[model samples]
Each structure stands twice: as C-alpha cells, then as structure tokens.
Target: MEESEELQSILSYLPLLMRSSSLFWPSQAVETLRELGGGRVDSGYLLFQAISHLRNALSLSSEPLSPSTALGYALFFDEVMSGEESRKWFREVVPVLGNLLLRLPSLLETHYQNPHNSMRTATALRLLDSQLPGIIFLSQELIAALLGCSFFCLFPVKDRYVNHLPVINFDELFASLYEDYNQKQENKIWCIIHYFQRISSNMPKGIVSFERKVLHLKNDYTHISCPDANFWSTSTVPLCRVEVHNSGLIEDQSSDAVEVDFANKYLGGGALGRGCVQEEIRFMVSPELIAGMLFLPAMADNEAIEIVGVERFSSYTGYASSFRFSGDYVDEREVDDLGRRKTRIVAIDALCSPGMRQYRTNFLLREINKAFCGFLYQCKYQLYQKKLQDNGCSSALFDAATSTSMETSEGKFSDHKTTNSQNDYHSMDQGNNIGVATGNWGCGAFGGDPEVKTIIQWLAASQALRPFISYYTFGLEALQSLDEVAHWILSQRWTVGDLWNMLVEYSTSRSKGETNVGFLHWLLPSIYGHDEVIQTQLHCVSCSETDKRVVGMEAYLCGLLAHQHRYGLVDYSNYWMLCVALRPFISYYTFGLEALQSLDEVAHWILSQRWTVGDLWNMLVEYSTSRSKGETNVGFLHWLLPSIYGHGTGMDFSNLA
Candidate 1:
C-alpha cells in the first residue's frame, strides 16, 4: 500500500475503531491514529478525525464506556492537537464537553456499575486532568459533577483506601491547573478549592498561598504577615539585589534611620498606651511586688486569691458593694392605703475579698415600680383624652363626680398628681363618657396592643406557654430586679432557675441564719399547676418526704425557663430539663410497654417541635446512654437502644423493612 493511501485509510476508519465495543485490538487502532497524526500527514485533518471519532463515541451512548478506554481516546486526540489547536478546539468544544462532563455521572451510574468501573472512572478523570485540565479548571459545578460520580461509585464500596482513588493526588492536579489560568481567574480557583476543601477531609496544599493572595487582593491586612516560622519557614536567608548609583552624593542615611526609629517607637508606644491602664500596670509588676504590696508572701502557704463579699452560686466568688432585687418598688406612702407598709426587697451583691468593692444595688426597683405606675398613668391619660373627644355625657355631672372622687382620694392622689392643672385635665377627660379607649388601658394593657394580646392568648393555650409568659411578664421582670441588685445577674444572662440554685446555696450557707429559698422554690407550682406538684411529690416521696420534690421541680422549671430565655425558643435544653424534672416519674413508669410509649411520645415531640435534627439525634444518644445504665427507665432502653445506640438485639430489618 502507498504510504499516503494507507494513512488515509487509517484515518478513515479511526472514528469507527474508537467507537467499537470490541476491546480486542482497540489499542492497535489508537496507535495507528497516533502514528498517522504524528507523521504530520494532513495534521489538522488527522486531528479533526480523532476529535470527530471521540465526539462520535461520546454521542453514541448515554452510558459511560470503561473510563480507561474513554481516557485513552481523549489522550490520543489531545496528543495530536497542538497547543494553539487545543486552545481553539477548547474554546469551540468546551460547552459541549461541559455538558458531556455533567452527564458523565448519570451515564456512569448506568454503565460503569461495578467495582472495576470505578478504577476506569478514575483513569478517565486522569485523562481529563491531562487533556481537559482547563475543563474542570476552576468550574465548581464541573468539579462537583466529577466528585459526584466518584462519590456515588465509591459510596457502596466498603474499603476506604479504594474509595479515595478519585481525590488522591488532587492537590498536584489543582496546582498545575491553577497555574495555567491568569490572575483574573484566581477568585474562581479560590471558590472551587474552598468548597472542595470543606467537603473533603484531606487538606489541599498551597491553599495558604491562595488565601494570602486573595487577602492581599482584598486589602484585608488583619491576617497579613510575612513568611513566619509557624507557616512558611525557610533555612536560607533571603537576599535583595539593588542597583546603586555610581554618582555618590552620599545620602544623610543616619538621620533618616533615626527619624524612622523615633516614629516607630512613638507609634508603638501610643498603640500600647491605648489599652487598659490597670491591665498594663499589672503586667508591669512582678508577683513578688504584688504580694508584698498586699501584705502577703509571694510563696505563702495560702497563695490562693480570695474574693470576698457575696459568695454566690457562680463559678467565681467575688465582692459586691450594693445589692437589691429586681422589681418596681411602690413607695411606702402610695401602698399605705392598700395597708402594705414596707415592701420586701432582696439584694444581690458580689464582693471581692482583701480589697476593692463594686456596689450593684437594686434601688432601681423603686424607679421601675414608678415606671410601671407611670405606664398606668399614661394609660389613664390616653383614656381621658379619648373621653374628651366624645360629647355624650354632661360636663357638669362629670366635673361633680371628678371633684367628689378627687376630694375623697385627695391625700392618696396628691403625690401622684402633682399639679392642679394636671388634675383638672384628668377630671375633665374622665368626665367625657367616650367608650373609645387605647388598647393599653384595656384588660391586656401591659401586653401591648390587640396583636400582643392575641399572641399572649395563643401562648397561654400552648403547652410551653407558662414558661414563655412567666419569663416575659413576671419571672423575667423579677430577674431584672435581681440583676439590678447584682449587676452581673442580668435577665436572660442567667435563668431564674440559676438564680434559685444560687439562692438555695446562699440560704444553706448564710451566717446570719436567714434562710429564704426566694421565688425560685415557688416557680414550679406557679407555672405547672398544683397537679404537677402532687404528681411530682408522689414520684419523689421515697427520695424525700419534705418538699424535696417541690424543690427539685422548681429547679427543673427554672432550668427550662433559663434555656428558653437564652435561646429564644424551647429547645433540647428544655427537653433535658423536663427529663431531669420528671426523672422520678420516669423511673416509676419505666417497667412496661407504656414507658416505651412515653419515650416515643418524647421522640415524637422532639420531631414535632421541629428541633434541630442533630440535637434530636444527640438527645436520643443521651437517652440510650441513660437506658444502657440499667437505671429507672429500662423500657426507654428498648426504644432508644435500638434506634440510635445500635445496641439492641433484633433482626435488623429496618433497612429492608
């Protein structure tokens, strides 16, 4: 055969040979095509023929061929095409290639549906790395598609080593690919790598360089640093080559150096000086000096720092200068008519031992009480204004009634209504019989308007309503008062339950012999009703007969309330609190299928409440752990043990069933 004729014949049959299913002699066909293309006998024509053959193969089946064969074909075409030709071909063919790449996973799912096929897929990906490195280049969608194929192929496989084939050596491939693109493409590279890093466990190298470049581009100097020992350490000293002027008009170098040093020192000092004086001063002294100043030996036997004053239930014991409960304190004068003399006040104080005092007094309760009264006064004022707008009642009759009422309540009302004109205006507005009233003056005044009323009513009906209501209206208000007494105990910072625990501890330890459990002990009965109290008592009768159940119940309620206050919703914390609170009942009820049913109810509640799935899973794990202990809730063990802990004996039919 003539060489040209033979070359033509080989080229003519290349497409058909590439697409053939018969594996026998396929490499021979590939070699023939490569040799013809290598000879430069109609080079472009040969390259076109190879691409056409590959395109035909890609078009032939939706199913993926053995990736090795597919990759071999791709490499053959890539080898034939010159860099310029590759660029031209890529620009023209990439959209099509991208579409094909996207469909590759689905095709693999159908055709390459075996363990050996995964290796083929990996090989194909390597070919993609060689030929169409720019195809997956920085395209997250394309990379994700590629990863999807690998993940699905490997997911069913048990061996971890084999499964990692697709991702192995990815960093080297990425670095090489990124170097091909211009700086304009850096962001795309970053986004792609960032996502890949998040999902894949193996950390990609050169990532810090990419990150630094990105930060540099963004001008975010906060994280900027020179190559440091920790990150990019080097053994050799870096050298700089500078071109010096031969015309030596010597520069005044020493003065410039001194000026620079002076500026740096002053700026550094200014920055340092801006920090807390006390902290800076403390750092300046040695422990020996501090001990000596405080009249204690540096290495004395009692070296522990002591905080005096209120030793509250906090992790730290500290001194407080002033303490008062959170509340609106009515003056002894105003409530005197109600026959209430001196208002009871609780003070919370935190004090440090040996020195310094910070007073946190709840004198604000009186201020707050006045504020609530002011709110009521405002409500009354609005009502009076509304009445004045209406012309229904006789002005004289209104005036007479107002005068009589004012005269009769003169002494009590004098302080509250300071001005005569203000009193007259109040009486005149009260005289007008307009039924028109602001919602604030109605039955749901402090609840805001009708919307707030509606919300409150809805909450009142909810199972979780009690905690919600108490926290907002009274419980949280009380917490605020308590916080005022001790500035650190802010509402929502620590729950009423935490305060109660602190109070209980304080009551037990008070040297003055005054033991008041405070409102903490009353919280449970106030919220859950007397029936819950009775049930709790019955459950805890054996543990302690004298109010121990009540105390436990209160603690539990407080914990739940605190959780709600902090998180802005009832969550797993509340469920855990409830579990702790009802533990005695849980123990009593754990003997039979009914207990499992209750456990199911709790699980269902967790699901129904739309709690976080992770939190629910954790709760189930905790429940399983508790049940595994052979404690009270053995029946709970049956359900929790099987579902999450994976320890229960069964046919293991969940997967199949």
Candidate 2:
C-alpha cells in the first residue's frame, strides 16, 4: 500500500512533467544528478555515471523502473509510460539524459540565438547594497540562463549575513524533497519547472529591471524619531479612490497596477526554504523574480526593491501551508519597446511583531515609512540622470552600459557595481501616477493587523500621488468594515497628515490601555457619534479584583490606578496621574500595581533612592520603554530597573536616603 501511494504521488507530477521538458527534474533527482556532475565542472563523467547507473538499475527491475531511470524516461516520453513497453524504452531515455547533461554547460554559457552572451559573468554576479540607489537591467535571455544555472545548482553557497545576498541556488528547494516529500513542495517544484519549459521553448526577447530605492532620513536619525522629516506630515495629499474586494486576489485583480510582495527583509523569504506563502508563491509562478536574490541584499528598514517586467508563468490555488500549483498560465500582458512585460512588483517588508506589541506608536511609524519608500515613484538617480542629459551631455554619456558616477548638489551617489556584465536593463515605466495593488501586507505570520496595514498602505499611496488603490482582503471577515472605513475617510476628504495623526493617536490610546478595539471599530465611535465601546465590552474592575478582571496589562494598570484615585488613599490625584502616566513602567515592575499603590509610595521609593520626583519618573519611563521595546510584558522590573537603578551592580544602594 505504501509503495502504491508513492507511485500515485509520482503519477500526479507526470502531466506537468510532459508539458515542460523533463530537463526540469525534481530536486531529489536533481541532487542525484549533481553528484554525477562531479563538482562544478562536468568532465563527461557526469553523463557516464548517469548512464551506467540507469543501465544497472534497469537490469535489476523489469516491472518498476528505479527513481533515477523513471526521471530519465520522463525527459523523452511525450506520453505516459505504462505496461510492458516502459521497460523496453528505458535504454533510449538514458542517452537523452546524457545529451542534455552534455549540453547543459554550453546552454548556460551562451543562448542558441545569441552567439556572444556578454551578460554571463565570469565571476559571481555583482551585489546591490543599501548605500546607494541602484538599478539592474537584464535581458530575459540572461535571466533564463541564470535560472538554468539555479536549476543545475551551479551557484556557490552564500551566507546572507556576510554576503548580504539571498540563496540563489536551487539546492535548498531540491534538498527539501528528500528531507520531507510533501505536496506543497511538489507544487512549488511544478511551478518552477513549468516556467523553465515555457522559456526554453520560446525565450522572451524582453527585459526585466530591478531597482533599489532608499529614503534618506535627515540628521542620520532612524524612522519615527526623525521629527524633522515631513514625508507624511507635510503632505496635504488627499486619499485616493480605494476599491476593496474581499473575494478576489491582489495579483489577479490588480494586474494593471504595481503588485505588492509581502516580502521578508531577505527578499524571497522562505521561497527557497519550507515556506510557501504570498512572496514564495509569487516567486514560484514568476521564477524570474527569484533572480533578484542573486544580487540584491536583505532590505534595510528604509529601503524597498522594485522589479519591473517579470512575467508570471503559472496559476496557483490555496495559500501558505495549503498552497498548490494549479497549472500553466499564459501571461497576456502587453510588451513595451524594451521588449518588457508591463508588470511591476515592489517588495516591502513590514515590522514583524507577533503580538500586541505591534500596536506601539514607534512600530506604526516604521511600517508607514517602509510602505512610502516603496510607493514613492521619483528617485535621486532619475533626477540626476535627467539633469545631466539636459546639460547637453550625450544621452549615451550616462548610458547604463558604462560604469559612471552621478553626483548632484543634493548628494553624491554611493558607488554601486553594474548587475549585468554587458548592460544594465532599464525599467519600462516609472509609474508616477500608477495605483497600488495590495492587501493585508505583514498580516500573515508577521502578525500585523490588517485594518492597520490597509490604512498604512493608503497613506503611503496617497503621499506618493497614486491615483487609486485596489485592496484584496482574500475574504477575511474581519475586514468587512474595510469598504465602510475607506469610504468614510474619503468622504471626510482627510489628507495624508490627517489619517497619519489619527493612527498615531490610536496607537497612543492603545499603548495607554485606554482602548483595545480594532482600528475599524475604533473609527465607528466617531462615525456614529457615541461613547459606547464599538467592538468589545470593557468592564471596570475594583482594586481587589485587579488580577481577575478578565482584562490584562494596561487594563489591569488602569483599574488599579482608578481604584486608588476614587478612594482618598493619596493626598493628590496629581501624584496618581503621574503614576498613571508612568503606567507602562510601573505596570511592568515585579509587584505590578501593588508595589506603588499610591503616589506617596512612588515618591517615597524615589526619596529612598535620593532621586527628585522628576528624575525618578523620567528614568523609569525611559528605561522601561526602551528596555521592554513594545512588548506587553517586560517581565519583573528587577531585571531591567536594577541595571538602571544601581548604575552598576557594584554600587551600594544601602547609602540611599
């Protein structure tokens, strides 16, 4: 029964196998073939070992062909091999495998149509770094050749941290086959193999462009802390038209717009690993997108990478763990003068907080900045290129084929090596007024709230001057109020600053324990003009029931503070206000609210440590928030506060008043 089940799984992959040439072998079989290649150089021993192994395996079995032999037969047989004739045809398939193996090196070195493949680099492909705004243009033929290298596992292993590049080889994908043979991996393999077959039969003459965009924050300050930054606050841009569809998908529904890849910092994420989510699935269907991993480094917080003109080759069903390759898909998008498809993909990774910690104001700013960096169309590179050409320099002076440095009064360009050995491919369109096609970015395993992420993208697109945004919710019922919220915001004619300020206010309230309602429901209070809690019921707890109030963290702190205030336990509600202000810190301490029951207790603790009331509160808030990050639980305050309180463990606290 087990042997039969295994055979059935192999049978399932046969149709896609026949449609695509058998040269795209499964990873397990590919790894076996790699061993035959005898390291990087194929000295004819590869063909010898493969043929001898098949010959020996065939002699042993007349009924069931060995796995390697079956893969070899898959290369030649247009029809399914069945019955007695399968055994007779095994010998003929062996030489076909040898012929392909022999031709593999030359095929990758030079395309049949182009005699001199100048794009094929003699050394490793150049890496794109975060220091400079850079673009790489590659002919579709070059991408096909590089992908062929990946299929054969020819690229060397790279450490992402040291090299700042993602895994470009197919070893990991193929290695997964033997490690754990599963349906998802099989589906992924099908999509990639089918892409190779399509291109091998009819190579695209067009090009694809990959460019990195960086938003330089002023004074070297990071993200939200740069108060002088006016990227959002200065923008009076109004929200654009948003079409929220719960039933459709981003890639299919917004085919005409720039598609969002909910990417990892390391571009493809688990696309080469065990992951099969949004970014991974997209990479599988449009395998050319994977070529970005060959050169682009992990994205920095302020950076985004955009790839224009890569064609999608396959359709898919399901998502994440349940994902499956549906079948071959024919891309019908229009091609431009560059022979490029009119498709654009911008990859932006969001802050990954798998808990309520994501509700913090700082994280909100990070996400907004990252999205804006991607949506913004103009870059200093384009501006400098135009400036140089307008000065009567030959257009070819700055042609992508040469190693040129661009400097402007704004700033000097950081040095970047050309990605292609021959010519840097240019993007077909700048998409200045193009809308964005995105939905629930960072909402998956990253733990971002979809409601929050939707508004974040909207604010970004608006600031970038996009005309419209098509949001695909993938049928999440939590987002049924999405259309309602979008229309209401649009009806008010709120500018980018207006919506951004609202998000900042919402995050502040959430951090203070004032409200736990979803952003959509939170907006309803203003929409309907009522104080009633919209989505959830919040019950006030008395002092004694603080820990058992069915609420947590901030609520628990709120309850304890309110109870202490209601009773005349402290001389000043002002002091309790101070405690409430310091709630984030006091609540995270070892004794919880019980430690500083009243303002006097806090004052006394400070007095005991010889600190002024101002100094005490400031240090506590700064230390806790900084140390705790945005996490709800900072653990016993002793771990963090002791480091702050003692200055050093060697100091003697016994000398304090």
Candidate 3:
C-alpha cells in the first residue's frame, strides 16, 4: 500500500491495530499515539490525518520539496527513490526514519523552545552566520537529521538575510543527475546516501562542534602591526619540521594533523555545484562538514572556521574531475572529553590571483595573515572550554593550555614568541602543537605560486607555534626544489625572520620585472651563481634548437670559439689571427671554395667590430654564400654591417635555446 493510504486507513483502526497481533506497525508510531491516548486519542488521530494530507499534497508537487517538513521524509522514501535497490534499502532503514520523526520535537531544540537563555539561543538548531563568532554543538543524531533536511532540499533559497550563506540544499546535486549525469556528481550523491544509511543503522554517540574564528584588524595599513618588516625580519623562531610527500592526500594522510581546506571565501565553495576539488571532496566524505554552510557566511579576510569532531563516513579515490566515491568508511577516531571526535578541519581561503598579481607583497601578506588567523590556539582552546562548560562540565576541569619548544631533525628550538603581547591568545598551548597538513594552497585554479605559498604557510605556522608541517606537493613540477631549499634553510639555521627578508627581497625584484629566475633559484645563491656553469647548462638544454642549416667543421669551429669567448677563456686580437680562426670554416664549408681568398679584409672588419660568436658565424655564412646566391656580390659589408649587430650577445643564444 502507498505510505499515505496506509497511514490514513490505519488511523481509524488505531485501537484495533494496537491489540491485533497480525498487524505490523512501527513501535514508535504506536507509542506516539499511545502517549496521547485516553482524552488525547482524538488529537493523535487528527495528527496522523494532517500528516496524511501533507503527504498527499507533496505527492502532487512536480518540484522538489524541503526535507525539513515531517512529510518530506515520507516523500524521500516514496517518490524520490526508485528501482528495487532503493526499495530494498528503504525497507531496511524505514524504522529509523519513523522513530526519528516521531521524536523530532525533542531532537530539534529550536530557538523558540527557550527564548530567555542566550546560550540556548546560540546553540539552537539554526542557520550559523558571520555576524559574531558562533559555534553549534550537535549530537550525531541531530546531525543525521539535519543531513536529511539538506538531502531533500528543504533549506530555503538564499534570501536577503540568508544570502550570505552558501546553498545548503541538495537541489543542485539532484538536478545534475538529470541535467548532465556524470559519474563524478553521481558519486557525490552516493557518498551522501551511504552516510545516511550507515548512521541510520548504527548511530554513533559522539558530538561535533563548528566554530568560526574572526580576528579584528585595523583597515589602516600603517596601524596594523602584522606583516611588518621589523616584526617578521626579527622573529627568533626557527622553522618547524617540514616533510614533503609526492604521494597520498591531505585528508587521508594527515588526519592527525590540522587538515587545511583550500577553500573559497564562501566556505563550501561549489561543493553543492560542480566544484569537486580539495574543499568539495572533503565535504563529500565528511558530509557533516556541509552543515556549516547553512549558517556560515562568506569568510572575511581576517576570519577562518574550525570544525572539530566531524566524522568521516565515506572514503574515495581520485581528485576533482577524476573523483569517485570508493566505498563506506568506519570512523574510528577516538572521542575527546566532550564525547566528540578529535578530528579538526580548518577552512582557510588563499588569495585568488588568476593572474601575476598574486606575487605582489600585499597579497603575500594577506595569505600569511589568513593562515595565522586560522592557526591561532584560541580558536580551538577557547571554544573547547566553552563546549566543555556547555556539556555541564567545569571549564576548570580542563588544564591550562600550554605549549612547549619544537624539536626538529637539527635540534630543539624555543617556542614561538610573539611580539603582539597584547593578544592574550597568542600565548603557546599544547594544542598549538598540532602540525598543519597542507598542499599547494591557492595554486590550482587560484594561480598562486606554490613555492612562495609553501614558505608563507610555514612562517604562519611558526608564528602560531605549530610543531611541524606535513606538506603535500601533489606532484607539482614547480616544487621540485622544495626539499633542497628547505634543507638549506635548516642547515644554515636561518630563523623565520631571515626567510621573511629573503621573501621581501624576492618580491621587490619581481615587482621591478626581474622574474626570469624562479623563487627557489633566487633564494639559493649557489644555484644561480657561477655564470659560466649556468650558461653551459642553458646551452645543453637547448642543444637540439641549434640551426640545422649550418653544419660541418665550420659549424664546429664557430661553436668552439663562441664557447671560449663566452667564458672569457680565449681572445683573438688581430685580423691575421682572426683569419686563422676562420680558416677551418673557409676551407671546409664555404660553397665558393675560396680557400685562399685573402679573408684578411673580412677578418679585419670582424676584428674592428669585436664580433661575438654569433656575429662571426653570420659573417662566415655571408662570405660562403656570396657566390652561391649571387646577391653576395653586392659587397659583403653592404648589407652585413647592419645585420651583424643583431647577434651582439653570445649569452642571448641561451635564451633562444
């Protein structure tokens, strides 16, 4: 029988169905009606009638229905799902839904339940916002319920008040199945479906909290103390430990560390839309993280959001376009003091520079401050204490947060000391010891330079007192020198300030149009030093690019002499010696075969001009082709003088090559 018809027909026989052994009814439904029996049985019958009427109304609607309504769950089980597979899946999990809705009044502790208490108002089940730093602590059951609401597209569209928040409904995800129908989007839906299935069968008993951290800063650059040359250039703190991995992912490999979400300023990015990269993929596996989007607004430059105790319910392979939902995953992370998982995910957006502007000093400072704002210990510790107290535990029960010195492969270093003593939360704490697990932030579609970004994040982590950094390169070829540069800095025992100075110097050079050299090459003096060796390497790299038209012993002699002159190894002062130098090319490669053509005139012209290797070769080509092309009879010096100066610099060949 249809769910609405079954519900309606059974209401009149509630007393009979209650005693009939053959009738099969959900126990929660039976208990619900029983609770309101006696004088309230009529009220219970009216409740079921209203639910049936709502279900019939939803059944007729051609558009999507919001899951927040009680009948929406029925619509999900009936019309939305299809095929024997969904039916079979529904049969196994329908009781959980029935019980959930029957007890929705208690599960959903809305703000209206108690208007007098501010703490309750803040913690109530509602949309999180950007006004002030707010946190929502939810039980796993409540999270599943919210996810159900999101799954059915029950959340209202972004209106004036909610426009700041990202789209929390699954309408876009569902629409894609009919509009484009690709496996990537399909896999995302599968992941979310599997999460509901898993939670419905064996609901976990842990709590999760999402807190947004905002650090107010002055708009005036002159007044702001951060990113100051003196402060950054004088920090005594050494760099934390850094380990780069060519393989693996940030979410799976660095679960113990504070995982960074390469987020869009709008928290979830295109997670509900088409974006399936770092931030989107993270949301799919741990769908509970999506709950933050319902309340959080587009992040400000000085703000970040940290989600603690979110359980990862699905595991997957591939990234972005290649992403696929692999299979179910059981979250085994241990619970914290408040019966919450210990997993912490911090969302910090990098500056989006679709062009070369990201390399500027101002954007660099913005990224550094953004990372610092996310890494502050206060975000986790202060909110943690509040959560503990809200759970009816004493804040004093939690020990004083403390931070110790960091130990690197080189040796131990003192804890990071901040110059901004005015900020009390800048003080060290043990929780600050969590390393940051990050890859190239802002480099993918955002166009940030990975090498510079790696160092920026490192400096921020050091200032925030993180002990180590698990840096994932994701196989970017640009970061090939990351290990070498990191090792050199450690070997030299350079402090954060030293690196900051180097970065500033590099940025200055870049702004003045001197970016031929990359950041890593600029930082490592030894690599860019020895002009001769660099020139030689450049030539070797472009060896195939040599003009094939010019060949034989004359070409060899020209190359030899050019190499000699480039490194300041050889010099020919007079025309006689210069003729001797050109003797090989004149005898072997010239078409006119002018072996004894008294090249002294041409040689003296070459000598007087002090021609480089390229000029000499082009002069040789002119002399040899004089008879062959017949135009050479127009006086070799006539047209050659103007063209000879074109190849003035031997080093210019390296650029061409």
Tens digits of per-residue lDDT for model 2 on 278-315?
Answer: 99999999999988887788998888998888998999
* Number of residue pairs clashing in candidate 2, backbone atoms closer than 3 angstroms, sequence gap of 3 or more or interchain: 2
Inter-residue clash pairs, candidate 3: 66-154, 128-295, 402-429, 402-430
lDDT of 2 at 558: 26
Evaluation by TM-score, superior candidate among 1 and 2: 2
Q: Would you estimate the TM-scores of all the predictions? A: 0.15, 0.59, 0.62
Of 1 and 2, the candidate ahead on lDDT is: 2
lDDT of 1 by residue, 1-657 (tens): 122321222222112221232212234334433443234323333433443343443233332223333233234235434576555443433323324333433433332222122121121111111101000011223233333222112111122122221221112222332234232122222222223333233211110000001011122223211122111111111111111222211111111000000011011111111111111112111001111111111111101111111001101111111111121211121122212211111111111121101001121121112111211222233333344356555463333324322223223223243132222222311221111101111112112222222121211111110111111222222232322222222212333223333333332333233322232222222233545544433111111112223332222211111111122322222233343223322222223434344454444443354443233334455566777886536454355445444554522323210
Show where candidate 2 strays beyond 4 Å.
1-125, 158-161, 218-231, 379-428, 526-657
Query: In candidate 1, what residue range of length 10 has the lowest lDDT sum?
Result: 206-215
Best by TM-score: 3
On a 0 to 100 scale, what is the lDDT of residue 643 in model 3? 37
lDDT of 3 by residue, 1-657 (tens): 122322332223121122332323345334543332222322212433433332333332343333333333333334455656455554554445445544443454341243223232244444445645556677777677656546534344425133566777676665555556567877777788788788877987777777676665644321222345465666656677788888788877643578899999888898887778899999999998887776677888778888888899998998777899898888887776656777878899998874566667777778887887777665333433344466674333222111222543111212334333322222322244467888998888888888888989988877665677889999988787788778766765556777776787777767777554567766653333334223322111011123432232121222112211123321122222223122223212222334323233344555555545444555556566775777645444434443333534322223211
Runs in model 1 lying further than 4 Å from the true structure: 1-375, 378-481, 484-516, 520-573, 579-639, 643-657
